[model samples]
Target: MTKHMTRKQLNSRVVDEIDRNLRQAFDDMAQQPVPDRFTDLLAQLKAAEDKKNSGGQQDA
Candidate 1:
C-alpha cells in the first residue's frame, strides 16, 4: 500500500529541495576562477597596504 504525505511533509520536502538547489548553485559559483581585473585590483590594494605598513611616504 502507498502512504500519503501530510501537508507539512510536502512543504518540508519542497523546502529541502529548494535549499539543496541553492546550496549547489553557490558551490558551483565558488568553483569559478576569479576575474583578472578583480585579482589585479586586489593585488594593488595589498601593495598599497604593505607600503603604508612599512612607513612608505604618501603621495603629496
Candidate 2:
C-alpha cells in the first residue's frame, strides 16, 4: 500500500529543507573574518562622513 502526504506535510518538508540549507550557509560564513575590502570600504565611508560633518560646520 502507498501512503499519501497532506499539503501541510509537504509544506513543512520544504520549509525544513530551506531552514537547513540557510543554517549550513551561515555556519560556513561564520568561519571567516571580515575581509580587508569590507574594512577599507567602511573606512572610506567614515572619512566621507567626517568630511560632510566638517563641511556642514563651516557652512553654519
Candidate 3:
C-alpha cells in the first residue's frame, strides 16, 4: 500500500523537523559553560565601571 501526504502535510513535517533540530542545537549550546577569559574580562569591566561611578578618578 502506498500512502501519499498532502502538500500541507509535507510542509508541516518539514517545519517540525527544522524546529526539532534548532531546539536540539540550542539546548546543546545552553549546556556549555562560559569560558574563564570572558568571565575575567566582564569582572574587569565591572570594576572599571564601579570606579568611574564612585568618582572620575584618574589613575596615577
Candidate 4:
C-alpha cells in the first residue's frame, strides 16, 4: 500500500524536521565550554582600553 501526504502535511513535516535539527544544533552548542585563553585575551583587551581611556592613569 502506498500512502500519500497532502501538500499541507508535507509542508508541516518539512517544517518540523527543520525545527528539530535547529534545536539539536543549539543544544549541542550550549554544551560546549568557552576556552580560557579567549576569556583571558578579552580581559586583557578591556584593561588596556580602560587604561588608554583614563590617560594611562596609575592611581594608587
Best by TM-score: 1
lDDT of 3 by residue, 1-60 (tens): 449998999999999999999999999999999999999999999998898899976785
Q: How many clashes (backbone N, Cα, C below 3 Å) per candidate?
A: 0, 0, 0, 0
Candidate 2 residue-wise lDDT at 28? 97
Per-candidate RMSD vs. true structure?
A: 1.9, 4.3, 2.9, 5.0
Query: Which regions of candidate 2 deviate over 4 angstroms?
Result: 1-11, 56-60
lDDT of 4 by residue, 1-55 (tens): 4499989999999999999999999999999998999999999989988998989
Question: Per-residue CA lDDT of candidate 1, range 8-40, in tens?
Answer: 999999999999999999999999999999999
Better of 1 and 2 by lDDT: 1
Task: Output the number of the lDDT-best candidate.
Answer: 1
Candidate 4: clashing pairs of residues: none
Please estimate how well model 3 matches the true structure, expressed as its whole-model Cα lDDT.
0.94
Question: Compared with the true structure, what per-residue lDDT tens digits does model 2 show for residues 1-60?
Answer: 449888998999999999999999999999989999999999988987898888744442
Error of 1 at 10 (Å): 0.3
Off by over 4 Å in 1: none
Rank ordering of all candidates by lDDT, starting from the highest: 1, 3, 4, 2
Which residues of candidate 4, in runs, are more than 4 Å off?
Answer: 1-3, 57-60
TM-score computed on alpha carbons, candidate 2? 0.55
